[model samples]
Target chain A: MKTYTRPLDLKNGRVDMSHGSGGRAMAQLIDELFARHFTNPILAEQGDGACFALPVGAGKMVMATDSHVVSPLFFAGGDIGCLSVHGTINDVAMMGAKPLYLSAAFILEEGFPLADLLRIVQSMAQAAREAGVPIVTGDTKVVEAGKGDGVFITTTGIGVVAEGIDLKPSNIKVGDKILVSGMLGDHGVAIMSQRENLTFETTIQSDTAALNGLVATMLDAVPNIHALRDPTRGGLAAVLNEFAQASGHGMLIHEKAIPVRSQVAAACELLGLDPLYVANEGKLVAYCAAEDAETLLAAMRAHPLGRDAAIIGEVIADTNAFVQMETVFGGRRMVDWINGEQLPRIC
Target chain B: MKTYTRPLDLKNGRVDMSHGSGGRAMAQLIDELFARHFTNPILAEQGDGACFALPVGAGKMVMATDSHVVSPLFFAGGDIGCLSVHGTINDVAMMGAKPLYLSAAFILEEGFPLADLLRIVQSMAQAAREAGVPIVTGDTKVVEAGKGDGVFITTTGIGVVAEGIDLKPSNIKVGDKILVSGMLGDHGVAIMSQRENLTFETTIQSDTAALNGLVATMLDAVPNIHALRDPTRGGLAAVLNEFAQASGHGMLIHEKAIPVRSQVAAACELLGLDPLYVANEGKLVAYCAAEDAETLLAAMRAHPLGRDAAIIGEVIADTNAFVQMETVFGGRRMVDWINGEQLPRIC
Candidate 1:
């Protein structure tokens, strides 16, 4: 094996154009930094790509990709590194699949600090370690100083869904109950606090987490679940709207039934934002037959990541396919999809 | 299905932050732009992730990723769009696998022209079509203007290698012959020409292409091929060094036998670059037992992409693991791995 004469100056060094040059500097970075942090048999092989046999009896393969251009790389609870992993894992898990592996590609801006890069990478390694999904293959590129943000990480995940487990929005049927795994808007509120430099008595941390374990528990408890989706990007309202549009049904939810952290709600109110339209990195929305809703909620609440689970709504027969919320005061209004950018680069 | 009142104005539109805000604007862009160009059954489902069953006879799975941050979006022959698909496909193909599907993630800069984005997407769809690989899922994120270049694309490919066809650098034998599929340095020279604004008598065009078909042909003729790789970022020299270090052997090549177009050589000379150190997107290197060399070469020559194929070198037993080239004038010198950036963002 090739060896570097000296170790990388991780503390004082900055990312230069050479680090992405595909030469000695790039090789050293891979060997000393990436390879060391993401140690695995497949990655250690250092082939152009990673090769592995699918586990016997594994079902259909599911693939998902997400680009993390989140501003303020570091938020209250997670950095872009961990967010990159958790975000895609949840996407695959939403399909009722077991995420097996991940591939990462990075576009780094020239002159970014190596120390920050190290911190981000370490966070990713820790997240992947906890999730039991190895990042088996990756690529890196660098743009001129002014041509890029500090860094953008794009992660792609591969998973397998066991036979007879189908979770699609089209499977949603009228009279099905809609449940949320946890509180909404924590991630979005956390990010907003950071961006606004808001100081609240209670700090709200982004709820970035890998939800595969929670999903597996729910699937075990209710194998006939119809639809599952993470409340990301456009949050609970967006997910409900998607379900309504896909299934040609209306979504009816009680505003009082949804779970939201007091601090998050206060933050949203102060910022003139609605919690329904805010994003959540860790929470998921599920649909099941009315009889199975209690069992599903119990399974979700038992999981560490889903302790605040609740059945918040139900699908209804309506020609307009609207998502309406019954207010706490007994009046109702539509919980429509967001119209424009509330926050940019909010993961 | 939800419908947009007006279609995306591809001719006069520019990407804005809302296009990535996971709102109505983002949905419209996806519905009218991405969904229209990359139309396939899997993508038409509009799920967060794409799901499919692996072929029954498919062997081990292969996964590869590449991030294309090429300087100019468009070049003489190909742009970053086709290059992104070809780059990842070639990486997966180098593993002796049949590429099955692709997932793309794009980081677009706010204020980037929508027309250019359309061109890139159309190019990507066309490339994927020509390669018989469908882009099953994708993501788009827009950064604030000036935070990113016009666009950066990262593509991840999944493939399956048939049983009994293993290709790895460690498989190379000391006496194996090394073969190159076609000419070298065309891609580097082409990009350099654009960057330098040098108009040559004969314009140099990038050689970016998907090599899966060519790879399939070679494998059919010589299933015992020892090693295979696409000479991409660090070009021929980097690949040779990688092979030598992995196999604990040395590489010895005759410079006269290497293929380089006259224009490419002139451009490299003007740019003070060594053709051996320049990048080639479509080219590949192969290592085979001496007995199978002729058969592999014959098969490669019959392929359109390998008409300029040649046996340029051979592996040798050397404890130091060096890469050397015999000059056309009979003098020998070492072809060392590149030490610094030659061309940044050269796909």
Candidate 2:
């Protein structure tokens, strides 16, 4: 309970081994950095963990986890901090649940700048606050200098699904209509441009935002939606393929209808990457009954994060579970899973 | 749904960027290693997250997280994988909860051997199985070759406490008794010996274990337990200081009553370390009413993990909230907070 003799030098200080030594230094760092930004009653208790009553009518609990090792911790539109929070929240939201809490675990390299750490924590707090989900618990560990990059953040989210809303890959029927929440590949292209130092006629920014609110809007309009997922690491190609395989069906989509901003499309073309295989951080693919497709699309398009929502595909019967796309050039090609590493540390 | 053309070469394979790209290689590694080991019904779904019904009587949920960055991934008695599981489980159990599930997120360094990764995952699987807590969800990310050490594992646990049990540091009264579960410094000494290449007359092993069962037994007998915590980092001294600070009281303990194995004590002595500030992986400290201390100690001793349980200290009224210990030679010394790092990456 005794305060440290000197305050942390956030302006010019750097993380050291003592910051993670489970001693006074660690306590000081927590009090000054983490607890200050993530100000919540539960975290203020500073117990071994956070304990709270599960929300009532919590028919089922959803848990999701993601580890962000994005290079160049700061990106165009977002940094790893907010991305870490949004990514896991979207995962839980994909299950037709309301995300309630998040737990963050940070692995920081020794000698990393404390200023950058503070910035990241502040962004995370803001993102969590905007999403209405507090980061209730967290942990911090420091690795030796060369043993780690600047930092890697792992976030786990807990959400509660309402009684009658069940969204799963198995629920996708052969005739379900497939719709995308927004444009594809903005996140990947933005990160790629930053890494390659490429200049484009137009600037590209990562489409990293929490999708829980958008998902809630869509689900409210179409509660019986069959399945939903965010196209993150493996992009739309991976998600479609996963759904096809899980449902023992095939997908036939119109590439022309899939929303892709011209800048992202041009960037992917110049980089020799398929937009289908590029990541999207703030977008989702939803499957619903054919009769409800228009209603669901209207709901999604009304949300800012899903303004470009479009129906791009429909499920079909195919024992092989192939995802065939009708190209914009009036041809068809199998939009297969990504073959190898198009991008590493792309979040 | 289609299997890879070639099975993963688990023996000679080294993780490359492709293994974490959310592509075929990543799928192959997951299918061949992680899925094969941590086999459970929930993880088998392989959704974005795992969704399950909360336990019916789940009065409140407790969540805890820890990131493991221990040096020499493998040690005498445990590896980072099992240590990560036991550490978080103990945290949740310290709150008088029954740990129900765990989520693991791994940041693997590129070029790390797949064999070692498999070993760690196997150990994690066995530990979770033995503890009766399933690893229900997880994620994996790869960093460029030199950007990271072999691997860092972060585990988050979710548990449900019974209706009447409410354990928090604020519950510690001025007259509460403090008891330690078992011998101290075994874990720290074991790791120190490995790092220092010190050969002792007696082999010392890390006391890494899951203490949920032991916690359940003790709580069953003493539902009114004031406070409980596991002394991991910063050891017993840190726990006492934290308790004193949090409860606005001082802690006075008899050094003679505290148990320390001779080998561990000798190792600490040789290393110029104090047993009081050395970590223990599988131990806990509990606070109870003075009159119930004997019953609590007896209940703890009846459990296998608490064979050496002893009432080592008592909370006293003190304005400064200092933690003082009575030495065997009739001298009193302040067991103050650790000011600097004793051992880095000791966890």
Candidate 3:
């Protein structure tokens, strides 16, 4: 077997027509990179579509689909491949389900670099493996250059939710406790550092990790959690506003309780972006009964991804659906719904 | 109920901030346009998300998701809304399934005309109803102007594939008959004609439609159809190429047997486009046993949408995986895979 350990020349190489040609080159690329990294039985089957038996269960299946179109394809701390898997998995997990399978569709620019695409595919496979999900089936298409950005990925995920665990915004009560899984705005800052002419020096890596394990741990600890939401594109503020409106309740938060890394806060301050509105890929907002707050917080903190978790707010009775934050300086300020896109294509 | 009879001033009106302000203006827009058109029980509920029960079934369910980002928002015959629904429903239906329900996620650019958005939504709802598929759930988010185009709609569809159908490309045989549902290239041409500087003088309307009913009729006529595919973005050429590769067989298409309208052919000639590479939203390609081809064609022609149905070709024995077309002038030519984008922003 060939080791295929050559590092890709990312700077000068451009994608060529041969990459999409289903020949020896395509086979070499798939075997050396895709197969090597995505070492699962289904992918190894090498069929036009993967076939697998569903897990035996009485639970209802939850399904979700997401498309990834982030610019530059390769981002700081993560790329489109991992982002695609993380996104759909989080969508399914947000339903308080165990994500089981994923289907990916790729729209490749005809001249997209084969090396870069291989790397991206490898990253996606690794992410899926870490999340304990399988890439069950996929479709690939080559679009003409300039017709598409380098690569666009759409992923659809299916998961199973146990019976009697009805998690919905309708389940939320006025006295429910709101918790943040970890630090905010890291993913946003990391992407901002890569933008043209807006360079900043910070080791802020994207918080783009699979959160299904953390979600499972939290759900195991508190099965009756009212609702779970991942703050992705529009960030924590947008999520809170949606939750408040959906649950028909007001939210009061202690700004000090929300965890934000110092570097992220500093970068946001420099960029004139609000940390609250900046995106976070590896974090979630959990709402549960006030009595289960402590138990949930302890369970969340025990997980690797949720060590800095904190009780951020509480739901209150009000048709206004206002989300207010008590500033560290002993004053309250309204955390309004995000007015518009804070940073385009942050996801 | 206030009836809205006045035609929309699409050309002169500019979108305003009030469109997204969630006030009386928004209500008028929703009621006069969206609600008036959609008129479904679930949408009438007017919750943030529509909730409904799934139909009982023992068949394996197939789900597909698609996002529409076509330029010009409104097209020749349809807009993003109908296209989004049709696209995903066609995806699920291609798997030999009965499309059941859909979930839509809308990312609207702030300052988009409330009337335009409503028009698109209403069109989508109408399309869903006409197909007997329900829009059961949805989410809407408003992005700031410049961060997005006018609007982008993502639709997720779920359907159940009846047992014993066994539709797969792997089942395609060397002697299988190839059948095309209708004339090709109308949808792609209609979109290209509206492009700036690529002006044309033809009343070409898009063939954008949901194909579930047509598929159902075909399945009823012949359940053992080996493979079914929709020739959309990369058109008939791309789809045939994929099927040929998947089945590890060669395909020979008869040019005279394939259906193409005069206007579509003329437009493709004028623009240097191959009709085989142009898209057909409402059409489909079916492969089945040659003995059953006549029966399938008869059932297809009985339907309104498939009146122009034809037996285009047959699979051939070849490890080279070629798709060859017989020329109109009695010569053979390769109906090779599309190399580049024919027209951009075409759904």
Candidate 4:
């Protein structure tokens, strides 16, 4: 093992156009940074793409892609690195499958700090390691300084789904029960706080966590989930609206049953943001047999990432496919899809 | 099917932040443009990720990802949209796999022209259709105007590699022959000419193509192919060096045998660039047992993409793994890996 006597100036050095020119400098960066952190037998092969053997007798497979352009590279809780990893993984897991491998492609801007790049990569590696989903293959490109954000990551995930364990929003039944794994609005609130330069004595951290483990536990316990979705981008309201539209049913959610951290709620009030429509990365909504709701809720609460899980709503038959919520003060309000997302680049 | 009464003013409107806001406006753009062009059953499902059934008893799976950040979204022959699709598809095809599905993620800058975005998406869809590969899933994010170039695309491809047909650089052996599928530097020269505002009498076209058809032809004609790679970013020199180093051997390329178009040669000459190091998008390099070289060459020549194919080099035993070229003047010189790539974002 050899170490450079003079390593890259991670503190003060910046990325140059040549680093992505597919030459020795590019090779050195891959060898020292990407390959070093994302080491595995498959990635080490370094072929045009990584190749590996798959498990015998696996079932159907699913693939998903996500582009994370979150503005503030680093947020209160998670950075874009882990968010990229977790987001794609959760997409695959939402189908009730175990993610097998991932491919990450990064676009970096010239003059971006190497220190930030390294930090992001290290976090990406850590997320993959924790999720048991290694980044098996990846690509990197660099654009001119003024032509790009510091960095943008696009992660694609592949996973295997066993036969008869399908999860799709269309499969949702009118009588199904809805459950939230945890709090809402924390992720969007945290990002907004950072961007608005609001200093909170107790920072509201983004709830960004991989959901496959929690999903596995729920599947093992309940065994009859109709659908699962992470409340990202458009958050809980968007998800419910989608489920209603796709399944040809209506949703009746109870506002009091939804979980929201106190700090997140305060930040939402300060920013005039509705927690119901704000994003949450670590949370998920599941629709299942009414009888299985308690069992799934129990399993979810038993998991560390879902201690505050609760049943939030139920699916109802309606021709218009509307989503309605009962307010805490016994008034009704429509949980309609917003004209535009309140938050941008919230991931 | 439905059409917007006042459709997005594609001819005059610009993409605003709301187009990626993950709400109604974003939904409208996806429905009117992306969804309309990429119309398929899987895409119509519009879940977090598209899910589909795979053919039973398909072989081992392979995945590849590439980010296309080529400046000037529209190039001489192809735009970034089609290039993104072909580039990732070729990466998978290099492993001798039949590409099955593709996923595209786009990062568009706020204020980018809506007309341009539609044109690019249409091109992307056409390319995917022509290649017999469906873009199964996608994500779109719009960054603030200054934070991104007009657009950047990252595409990930998944293919099923039939058993007993493995292609890796390590599989190359001494006494193997190296072949170039077609002329080099066309893709790079074509882009450079447009960038430098040089109008060739016969406009040089970017040789961006999906090579799976040609690859399939070669594999069927000669099943014992050792290694295959698309001569892309770092060009033929990089591929040859990688093959030599991976196989722990050396290469002796014949400069006289390597193909180069006159216009490309002229461009390279004007730029003082070596044609050997310039990129070719639609071309590939193959290393195989020397005895089968003629048969493979015949098969390649029969394909549309390989009319100019020729045996450019051969492998030899050398611990140093040097790549020495025999010039047309009967002189030998070392073809070394460059300190950095001569071109950036050529793909």
Candidate with top DockQ is 1
Supply DockQ values for each candidate: 0.87, 0.85, 0.13, 0.67
Off by over 4 Å in 4: A1-11, A196-202, B1-6, B196-202
Share of reference contacts kept by candidate 4: 0.76
> Residue B2 deviation, candidate 1, in Å?
1.7
Better of 3 and 4 by DockQ: 4
Rank ordering of all candidates by TM-score, starting from the highest: 1, 2, 4, 3
**What C-alpha lDDT do the candidate models reach, one value each?**
0.92, 0.92, 0.76, 0.87
Candidate 2: which stretches are off by over 4 Å? A196-202, B196-202
TM-score for each of the candidates: 0.99, 0.99, 0.82, 0.97
Candidate 1, residues B114-224, lDDT tens digits: the string is 999999999999999999999999999999999999999999999999999999999998899999999999998888788745555348889999999999999999999
Local error of candidate 1 at residue B19 (angstroms): 0.7
C-alpha lDDT of candidate 3 relative to the true structure: 0.76
Per-prediction backbone clash count: 0, 0, 2, 0
| Candidate 2 C-alpha lDDT tens digits along A1-347 | 55999999999999999888899999999999999999999888898999999788779999999999997799899999999999999999998999999999899899999999999999999999999999999988998899999989999999999999999899999889999999999999889888846565348899999999999999899999999999998899989998998899999999889999998888888999999899989999999999999999999989998899999989999999999999889999998888789889999
Weakest 10 consecutive residues of candidate 4 chain B by summed lDDT: B193-202
Q: Model 2 chain A: which ten-residue window has the lowest total lDDT? A: A193-202
Clashes of 3: 2
